[model samples]
Target chain A: MTEGVVVVGLNHRTAPVEARERLAVPPDGLEDAVRAVLALEGVREAVVVATCNRVELYAAGAEAESLAGELRRHMHARGGSGVTLYEHRGEAAVQHAFRVCASLDSLVVGEPQILGQVKEAVAAARSAGALRGRLGRVMARAFQTAKRVRTETGIAEGQVSVASVAVDLARGIFGDLMGRKVLVVGAGKMALGAARTLARAGASLLIANRSFDRAEALAREYGATAHPLTDLGMLLQHVDVAVCSTGASGYLLTRHDVATVMKARRGRGLFLIDIAVPRNVEPAAGDLDSVFLYNVDDLERAVAEGGRGRSVATIEAERVIAEELSAFRAEELAQRSAGPTIVALRRRFQEVAAAELERSLSGKLRHLPEGDRAAVEAMLDALTNKLLHAPTVALKTAAANPDGDDVMRAARSLFALDAEPADPRGEVTRMRVQGEMTAKAKAGNGR
Target chain B: MLVGFLAAAALLYLIATVLMLTYLVGVASTLPSRRAATVSLGAAMVAHVTHDILRWVTLGRGPFAGIHEGLSTLALLVAGVAFALRLLGRRLETLGVFVAPLTLLMLLASQGVDAQPAAPLSGALLGVHVGSTILGTAAFTVAFALAAAYLVQEREVRQKRLRGMFQRLPPLEVLDVASFRSIALGLPALTLGLVTGLSAGLQEVGRGIPIVSWRHYLALGVWAVFAAVLALRLLAGWRGHRAAIGTIVGYASAVMVLVGYFVRGARL
Candidate 1:
């Protein structure tokens, strides 16, 4: 039977936010919980990746099915009852690990936060001494895949967040915003956020609202100038950029006002960002020479476009993940298949050496010296290592390939290792031979 | 050697034209491939330069003296400048596709014309006129490339709703600024060139070519169009699609003057 790693848990898809919150492990409790998972019968290794959107326990064991049920029970006892658990073994586990790290499986698709979270989880597991061998390899592969996905895909094309989208449009018009004027036509949360984004980009800020007092108070936070709505026309002629998000029912700046401002500014380019629900800048104002207008809908369209671009990257990432996992699974299976034969071969060699030593020392060497006997034993040990070196290397190479099991069976039959499955000393020989063959297969396939 | 070089340059010109068409139709993905196409044109340019240099060395006179050699040398200069810009990371690769074909056409037309050099001019004023006009033409060649990129980008954004193309191309605002930047630089150069040409004509007195000849008139018209574009951009903030189209028109008229000279030289 092939030994494998399995992960089971509920994410945003299988569980609602309330259920996930109840199941969420505090960062401090993660290590202790992972230890508890290792305590389960047949669990060789374990790690818990817990986030706001997902709670998954990844475990490796000879008896994966039993370990999975135990993990599910532990999660339920921790108050995550009735949550769906998807089981992935071997290659499936590897691919799932990569997908999680890449953010292809993220709720926001291409948002870059999840990879760091996964890295933290892996680090915590390593420090706890719970990560070893297969689990460590899987985690490393996941990190690599995530990096490749970012480099190869246009997933991160446009700004998805509101503040960033505003900044993007602003930069498009102004090129470099340093020393440029940006007028904020409202003092609401979004306007404040947009103001912060613009100010950070080195644009001088002007806040205009119907309630001048609130606008003044908000403007003071970023050291910006404040103006009442009546002065917006005058402000428009001076500012290079404007962002309007007033909860106005109708247009605050009409075509006539924009035309007059354009004439006054002598046709210097103006960028208008309208974030209000009912729309603040009149659509006709866009027709003015040197005027560029973008409403909420345009920003939303850009976000959607960014999302689509990320999806294309996601497809490419999934293909890479699948290929990597398949290679990993094949290597694991090959090594596992060669285990018994390697042990048998080593045991047989030791038996022959021991018999020869007993015969030689009983009378002929016994009459000589104890030092002489010890020297002969040392010589025998060296001879055994030298004789076994090539086969051992070959077996290990075979064990690491996709078809490693076939190589292992051939090695076992050729060496007559199938005759003895028990006896620890004999089993060592069998497993050693099998391990070497598996390793050899892996090496050959790699070429 | 001259004939072999001319043939290779013509072949490269044809390849660049095909590649540019493929790129404009959205069949190609990377800008570097278009840039590679220009490298081939650059190889062709090396050959064109060699041909002109060989003629000058063998005949023991400046290649710019005859209408045949003058037009050919100008074409070689244009291609050389275009290749230099491509090396400097200017995306004027597509411009070579348009320019190399025009250059080759001029060179081929020159072969059929009178090979004799023009009667030597009397003063340094004529040299200044010729030098400035060539420099102005080179500047306009770059302007034409920027205008072409703008037009292609505009069409792709409008017709395909292609976010990839939209993002890949510089922003519309950036393109408009670049176009103005080119024209602003080119206008003064052309003005100096035109003024020097008029001065040269005055120095020659009755022996001077007519200012109202088709070649001179086309050059004047091209200068006027560029002047108008610069005024509109500065005074009215004319930009985007309209500005791009204006640059294309202005540059096309300038190219017409070069073609006019070629045809007239052939008949003579």
Candidate 2:
């Protein structure tokens, strides 16, 4: 089930966002896209994962590598023409699926949205009747792999954006943002961004701007209060965090202003976020007691640091995905290799039991009643099954390891079963041919 | 027998300290996990209190009597206060990095001093002076440890390069408040100790001792440092880094008083 899995598409890394946007299929268009891929000859099972950052088609079939070209062509025709595409086949393909589902392949390596996006794609493909057999099992196992990665690793530990990092810094200072008061100095984009994150963290926000109208407008959105810029002093004394992004030319709040407010708050910690262009808050204000002030550059540096921290976890996540892929492949190979061998061994033993029963019934048990003879034949068949059970169990159990394939071949040859299952699956072909020859032999003998 | 318990406690404290360092390093952490370190520290504290009680009973005197007893008692007080704070659910247990080793050091320092027991503290004023002074210094010791934590956490926040050991600390606000509270507790105790000491000095003037000995002056110094910390925190906005540094300085004066007693009592 893990083998012959293929993914052919372009992501943010392989193609630009413009290219990705061109190739992206809308949510409603997903089933149609997957059905189109399934219509191709060598694509037995198919799914289309199209998000803002990537567009991919996953397929499983007998000739999966061949389907990669067709999937690429199909994607190009669906508006990915100028975009470069990448393809992974077989074991590499299975690993690519795991990485994608785990979000190691996303532009933001540990972002969580990719997992749900791919899950939707799988659902869409299932709806289109294109998800069955190997591809379906592979995706189900991929979800399991993704779940393990999320729980077992620290890949998603830190906030990566400026606004979210502001929240993280506040929590580091205050432990919890619940009921914490945040003062936004100006109604600019950066200030609004920071205010939104803080308000979402359960903080009560107060928007203060020179234009009272802008403050009131932003305040209405957060269900918070609006105050004029002149009220910054009284407001600063009350709030735990003050985001200063005003467009004032000089220091709107000087070191002395912050120091006075700190004294008013009785030295309770105040976090000042100066994300303005001309830097509204004075740089020296950070030196005051219980005042933690961070400017735009400092916040950006912290954001970058968070990115570097996740890279270490990214390596750990990669190791996890590698382990899951190998485990998945081993289990799949065990079923593929041991399954047919077990069947052939059981057939050979049952045939021998049947021939002996026929000879005995005709020559020695000629005087027995019909019912008694039928019980004897049932007992012989049960003996053959019991005899072959141990070897069948051993062969399948051994198939879970690398050397299990060799043991499977040895078990086949020991039973005089024709050919090996590993040689492009010649065991099935040989079994079919042998069955046909056996039918001809029975006809010629006319027993 | 007291030495036996002390030695066992010192050994346990050493093991607990080493285990804590390893736990911080992310190694040697298994089923006998962080809980083992906490248990060992608890046992060490138990043995420490037992050693103090045995000596107190043997001599029929409080631990405030002499330099050895005073240092040993101070060590126990610091550990007890820190452990209590942790049990109160403040995320400040990392202060044990300073408390544990300092307890061990003080125990060894106490043992190095003369062993002959000083007579028990008599006269209510003198007893109060000794008791409150030692208690006040113990509180200062806690403030000192918290100040160190505040400095580290403050640096991490100020420099904006928060990596390992940064997240391990309690938030800057928590550390600042905790350090300030320790100072708050110490200030009153030291003030009471000084007032009683002054009353005694005025009543018994120049009786083989000057009214203002070096310890009296040092106690005043510690008092003044904490006084400035509190007044500035309330009046001049001195609370985070500067306040932590001030608390550390105040605690240093308290340490000087202990060293003064330890050295002077040994010579006597």
> TM-score of chain A for each candidate?
0.57, 0.62
lDDT by residue for model 2 (A9-68), tens: 876567654465566576788999888899987988998987655788899887655778
Q: Individual DockQ of the candidates?
A: 0.11, 0.32
Expressed as tens digits, the lDDT of each residue in B1-268 for candidate 1 is 7788778877876776666556545577477777667767777777777777787788754655555775676677767765665565433344455566666666775675577633334345545555566666767766776677666665544332335444444455566676688788778877886786655555545565443355656778999998888898787766766777888899889767666655665332
Give the poorly placed runs of model 1, Cα more than 4 Å off: A1-159, A169-172, A191-195, A307-447, B20-26, B31-35, B61-63, B88-123, B148-162, B171-174, B199-212, B232-245, B262-268
| Model 2 per-residue lDDT tens digits across residues B1-268 | 9879999989988887887666544475454756677788888899999998988889765777665776788778777865675466425666776677777767776776775533223466556766787787777788888888888778888888654456666777777787788788888888997787676665556465444566667778889998999899877767778899888888788667666654665442
Candidate topping DockQ: 2
> Can you give the TM-score per candidate against the true fold?
0.54, 0.56
